[model samples]
Target: MADENQGFMGAVWETIKTIFWALIIAGVFRTLFFQPFWIPSSSMKDTLLVGDFLFVNKMAYGYSYASCPNIKIARFGIDIDADDICGFLDGDNTRVLAGEPERGDVVVFRHPVTHQDYIKRLIGLPGDRVQVKEGLIYINDEPVKVEDGGTFTEVKEAQGPERRFPRCSNDPVGEGGQCVKERQIETLPNGVTHSTLNITDRGDLDTTKVFTVPEGEYFFMGDNRDNSTDSRVAQTSFGVGFVPYENLIGRADRIMFSSAGRSMLFFWTWRSDRFFKGIE
Candidate 1:
């Protein structure tokens, strides 16, 4: 009986050790290489969907305080933010072994004030003047090229875990009906082109004052121009303003998986085409 009990206890210890090591390795991997992200809104529209799942390439722009993983489990009463792990690196707005991010790059960063993670396209770099006029973007007094790309359509139904309904240019859409938004292809000064969606002809953000991006900061905007509350709005208003360099977490390069249902276990809702789909 003693031999049998000893053997069982030995197995339990081995299992516990294995799990502990596995978690340690995963934490290191997530901090140094890639961190998984899920799209929870339509801000990026056709580029990223509500259920799109992708890994942020942490090495794409090197490491910063924002590179540290923010773990928050309310039920467990656990809340660990980036500052908790790398507070010493904060406030400097610098990154170790950093590479410059180009205009039009889709990036994920921590909100300057709230410290919450947000994903958007980099629009203005340091010392650039950015503005939106009549739903068109202008950089340093010159407008970027915008070409009509037709309409983007989706079902007018609650989506994802949030159960949020998509805003549409053609409103009054009944549930299960087709919701549409006008799509336009925008080309930045660097010649990078991406699709932007318009839900209304006149949106509050369609026309805004020229915002001069300060040095060591960046301006970002959502692809869903009308629906996004981005750099166009001030951070004090609960919108993402100019993000500091240290706040940038990483770049999003591709979608590894996606699901349209509330739970990922609902295999029938999986989007097969989005598997390994590269983000442009």
Candidate 2:
């Protein structure tokens, strides 16, 4: 009887040790190499969807110990980035390496005001002059070329009582009311191309003053032009203004999977086409 009890105790201890090692390994990998991020909004619409799951390459910009501790562990109840906006380095904490994002990269960063993580396309780099005129992007006084794609329609099955949803004038003049948006292909100066949604042509954000990116800051914008509150608006106005270099967490590498917010058990809700899709 004593031998049986000892055997059971030994097995339990071994199981605990195995679980501990597994967690440590996963945590280390997530901290140093990559971590997953989920898209919860339509800000990146055509490029990314509301239910898209992406693998953010943390190593893309190196690791800085001066950055705030991972929220999962720190439990600070704050959404701030690990690093200070000014890139201040703690005496004992140093950057593990160095890397920088290019103009067309899609990055995840911490918002200055809300301190929440946001993903957007990098539009303006340091010292670049950026502006929007008549729903077009102008960088350094040169217009970024755009090709007309066509209209994009969003279909939904009403879950509750019918409600009215305000829509852009250009939306298909549907008798029953439909959600529609204009789609266009945007070509960046670096030749990288992506699609953008233009819900309206004359909204307040369609035209803006020229923004000269500061020495160490960057400007990002969402693909859903008319809906996203991005760098186009001033930080004081509750928008994500110029982002600092240190606020960047990682570059979005690829979409690992997607769902339509329905139960995972419902296989029909799985967006199979988006699985393992590469973000342009």
Candidate 3:
């Protein structure tokens, strides 16, 4: 009996040691190699939906301990190769000025006003003039095209209401204060093209002042346009003003997992459809 007791204790110690080592390895890999982030807003909508969990390639750019705790010589975040980058360290704690976020890449950055992490597609880069005329985005005096993904189909929420627009789709024309939306391809100065979404008759297209993506600063707008308060208006003055580069977090890579919000205390109510759908 005494021998048996001693053997059990030894086995337990070995198991604990194995678990401890595994945890250390996971922590290091998560911080230095790849990290995870979750979507919490509809700002990116069809591209990256809310409640989507994603794996960000930390080494896609680089990392410094400055962003993560328990280390010195901190790195703000990874510098992505694309305009929009993802894999945020901490939502509120990011610095963007060190690098240039590319055009058309969907990125996760710190909101200028709230300091909260927000993911938005890069429409204009530094030294470029950005304008939204009739929901069409024009950069450097050229029209950017948005790729069409077919009309969105959605089911109305209760009652005999109009058809519902799917997550990636926008309603046509403004009804219930929503504008008609479409997808088009955006072409950059280098002739590179990317997809974008727009809502007709929405947003303040004509502004008294022209916005130039300031040096060491970035201009951003929500894909939702009229529904989002971005760099268009002054942050303290009612809307998001000019965002500093320091507010940038990281670029979004891809969707790892997605699930619906079901708070019911049952197993069958879980969201199963969005489990592995890639972020488009």
Order of candidates by TM-score, top first? 1, 2, 3
- Which lDDT value does model 3 have at 229? 59
Per-residue alpha-carbon lDDT of model 3 for 123-165, expressed as tens digits? 6677888876666667777656656644423232211112233
lDDT of 2 by residue, 86-180 (tens): 24653332345768889889998777666677899999999999999999999999999999989777653221122223244455455445577
Instruction: Give the candidate number with the greatest lDDT.
Output: 1
Q: Rate the local accuracy (lDDT) of all candidates.
A: 0.93, 0.78, 0.54
Clash counts for all predictions = 0, 4, 28
Q: CA lDDT of 80 in candidate 1? A: 97
lDDT for model 2: 0.78
Top-scoring candidate (TM-score): 1
Model 3's alpha-carbon lDDT is 0.54
